[model samples]
Target: MLNVARTVRCIDDAACEEVQLFTEEDGEPERLGEYRSVSGLRIDKAKVRDARVFRLWGYHIPIIVDEEIKAALEANGIVGGKFEEV
Candidate 1:
């Protein structure tokens, strides 16, 4: 299961760009990606605007996804653990 924790740290696009995504490798945070996926391919603008920090499994996956992504994930058996605000 993947656990996601939403944060209000990203108040705007520029600020969101400053956020970093990391992987929980060896029980530690490892730099893996950035928050610029919002400008990537096949992404929903509305969803990117509402993006939040998702703790995917054990990695802090800071990326953007829409309801379709969520639905697909759930449909594939991934579930949210709990509601967390930060």
Candidate 2:
């Protein structure tokens, strides 16, 4: 099991993928392609998606963000919050 208590510490370095503007109750994540294959993605502090911060597993992720959400993410500490890319 992965101990999620540590933010930077993870079981494996995998690039984060874009889930969705809103998470589906079914616990499914939406996939977005990436430009580069990466172990993990650090959430952009500036682009806040919503109450929850979004993270991608790696660098060249192909997920698109909403205009408003992108702006908010950039302006906030979406990276340091209660969310991490798996």
| Candidate with the greatest TM-score versus the true structure | 1
Candidate 1's TM-score reads: 0.26
Instruction: Name the top lDDT candidate.
Output: 1
Give the Cα error of residue 82 in candidate 1, in Å.
Answer: 7.6
Off by over 4 Å in 2: 1-61, 79-86
Question: lDDT (CA) for every model shown?
Answer: 0.40, 0.36
Candidate 1 Cα RMSD after full superposition onto the native fold (Å): 10.8
Give candidates' CA RMSD values in order.
10.8, 13.8
**How well is each residue in 1-86 modelled by candidate 1, as lDDT tens digits?**
34555533332444332434444653444444433233322322444355543322222344434456656776888665332222
Residue pairs in collision within model 1: none
**What's each prediction's TM-score?**
0.26, 0.21
Model 2 / residue 21 / CA error / Å: 27
Error of 2 at 19 (Å): 23
